[model samples]
Target: MISRAEKSANYLILVVFAVFAITPILTVLQAAFGPSDAGGGGGFGNFADAWRIGHFGTYLRMSLAVSVSVVVVSVLLSILSGFAFGVMRFRGSGPLFYLFLLGIMMPSEAIVVPLYFDLRSLGLTDTFWAVALPQVAQSVAFGTFWMRAYFRSSSRALVEAARLDGASTRRLLWQILVPLARPAIVTMTVLVFMWTWNEFLIPLVMVTDENLRTAPLGLAFFQGQYTQGFTLLAAGAVIVATPVVVLYLFLQRHFIAGMLEGAVRE
Candidate 1:
């Protein structure tokens, strides 16, 4: 049904957008591998130098710990809440679910000031919980929305069958529904992990200790100190971004499937 002109136009549009998106990344790659004034090194050597000079080893560990913690806590809470909202209706459930959606609509920047003051009051400033807790809350909002869509559209026959088999609510969820929700859960996990890993505003405001600095936060300070060192800056950017890239690559299939399913169902 499509004309050759339409196909060509589509390809052309895609090519243009691809170049637009890739240009900055390619520029960074070039800067990372190109010669620098700090030293004669290029390529991987630049990464090593950046890693050493930036203390990214500590940053990487801190980021992983915070991100992983956020993902685990957020995903679990989202799943439980999603199951409740989607399958087990109760009093005032609609209002409560809407409250959760408000979280998704709220901007982090809007809350950063209040969040910092609250954390300071609790004496959680400069601590891992300071970064992880807010991110967990944000991620759970989206995850609940995502998983609730999945559960709402899931097979009612299977749920009824589980009930007839005398499966308790917790057992039914974990032993039956959880396995079938793998694609959706994996997709949610990947997304939450990415968000938590890339989050900057919360970590920047909450923690001041160098040892607790996440990769992105550390990269910001590293850029400040090495403003003239383009090669090192580029290399540090690559280092900070690589884990997210690798994670997406590994989980792309599930993520795509889950997204398509969510789209069709919604």
Candidate 2:
């Protein structure tokens, strides 16, 4: 148990960190809605201008497509692979899982140059699949690792009980285990969404098509536009960030619960 003084210190530290985290967002909001000079406008005006100038509508839609595809495919594969690794033991399973560990350990920068050439050789460059497929692979690698740990730590007694009741493997996984793993699943989904949404290098390297540009890439280009000012830039940042922020808030309870659960398990 924590002492009163320790609890107070913890609260103080949390407050400090909270303020630190919020400060930049508050500053960006101020700049985003700040008064404009010359012929420009403030508040919604900057956002509107930024949206139009940045072509973020198209960029965001493309990003949404990639993110959704990556999340869905990767998380599903993660669940299946994780279940196999965590719940069942088989020959060479340890080495194969360790091979996946390489994916998590190796940075994209190391493989990206070769990957781009490989994709080009396969004639997949400048396409939606080009931008999304690599990310899917990367996300799956991490997601597998993540979900495997969750399943491994899950209540084996419950699993045994389900088995004794004549549950099929499919029923056991989808009906019994998956429901209980909601918080963990949601946590992984949130993480993958954030990662896929923010991925720059993959999309940048794979697609040169303007229509395939992701939000971050678009923002980078938007910032380069000479006519755009600081307010507009800030507004663009806010726009790009809003979806992930909303997602995290919507899944906040589950995400936090998963984090705490992982901590306890660790």
- TM-score: which candidate is best? 1
Error of 2 at 76 (Å): 0.6
Clashes of each: 0, 0
**Poorest stretch of ten by lDDT in candidate 1:** 257-266
- The TM-score of predicted model 1 comes to 0.91
lDDT score, candidate 2: 0.85
lDDT of 1 by residue, 1-266 (tens): 99999999999999999999999999998898887657756778889999999999999999999989998998999999999988887999899989888888788888989989988998989999989988888888888888888888899888999999999999988988889998888888887787788888899999999999999999999999887668999999999999988987888886666556533211
* Tens digits of lDDT, candidate 2, 217-239: 99887877645457888888999
